[model samples]
Target: MKAIVLAACLVCMSNGAEYVVVVSKKSSFGALSVSQIRDVFLQKRRSLGEQKTIPVNVLGHDEVRAAFESRVLGMDRNRLNAYWVKQHFQGVTPPLTQPSFESVKAFVENVEGAIGYLPGSMVDAKVKAVYEF
Candidate 1:
């Protein structure tokens, strides 16, 4: 049990989900404030230009989820889990979750008003990372 625990911890530390806030390279929208970014990620957005904001997530068990919670929302895992539970009961689904970074980038590129984070290595011509956390 201890070994399993230690291994999981190691994996968590080493394989955090890496992602960046993306914008269309053609977009004139300038740098977004932390509060604005948070609002988008938290589904608190009113609009992003003509379209709305789309918040994307990685897998439920991914390290990026925990890292993003802490870095973006200042919430820890247990608290975030509780938050989702409450939101689900309230009929408010959280952000869309992709199984891999590749899917995240693809979603962002194909969808307008859509912004998401994916692994750093998955970046390409389709999107520009405005911020990284």
Candidate 2:
């Protein structure tokens, strides 16, 4: 079992896939915690302080999205589906989805109060990375 776990970790590390949570450079938030990021993505909290927050989602099958969901949000697909269904019944909606990480990054850069996660390598000066995983 330990060997299997180690092998999986090695595979993940070998992929060189690192992820970052970013907000527009103009956003008031800085260095947010993982829990805060989770809340933003889950729509549990709408704003960071007085700034209205918009959370963006990358393509559903992207590895970055998978990493964010597992490492940051701490939930699997089944749980997320159930949670969203429950929230939907309550008139709550999930974050908006983008076709790719580049699209997500672009949206975050152009939109005030926007927050999203993507490959760390995709980050640039227009956005501030608030968290990494």
Candidate 3:
């Protein structure tokens, strides 16, 4: 498990990008605890305080996605897949997905209350990072 995590970190570092959870600059949603983030991502918590929150994900198995899953979600891909499968049966769908970091940033920027993760280097004035991993 440690080896896998190390590898994931190394992969991100090798690409010269650190990952962070971000929200629109206009969003009032502040920083979040890991458990809070977990709940939001899992669809256990629908909103951040009074504001409706939308969690966005990067499509496919990108390295940044893998790192976020391992470090923040604390679940392997297979386990997460199974969990989502069960969620599907219950009619709880996974978060919306964007094709790449650029699209994720765009979505979060344009959509109010939207949140997502991306490489730290990609963050700009349009988005505010709520958490770092």
Candidate number of the best TM-score: 3
- The C-alpha stretches of model 1 lying farther than 4 A from their native spots are 1-19, 26-28
Ranking by lDDT: 3, 2, 1
In Å, residue 47's CA in model 2 sits off its true spot by 0.4
Candidate 3 versus truth, CA RMSD in Å, comes to: 7.1
For candidate 3, the per-residue lDDT at 87 reads 98
Comparison by lDDT, 1 against 3, better one:
3
Per residue, candidate 2 scores C-alpha lDDT tens digits across 23-112 of: 989888989999998999999999988999999998677777887888999998889989999999999999999998889989999999
> In model 2, which range of ten residues has the least summed lDDT?
10-19
Number of colliding residue pairs in each model: 1, 0, 0
TM-score of every model versus the real structure: 0.73, 0.86, 0.86
Q: Give the Cα lDDT of each candidate.
A: 0.73, 0.89, 0.91
Candidate 2 yields a Cα-based lDDT of: 0.89
Against the true structure, candidate 1 reaches a TM-score of 0.73
Please give the distance, in angstroms, between residue 116's alpha carbon in candidate 2 and its true position after superposition: 0.4
Worst 10 residues of 1 by lDDT: 13-22
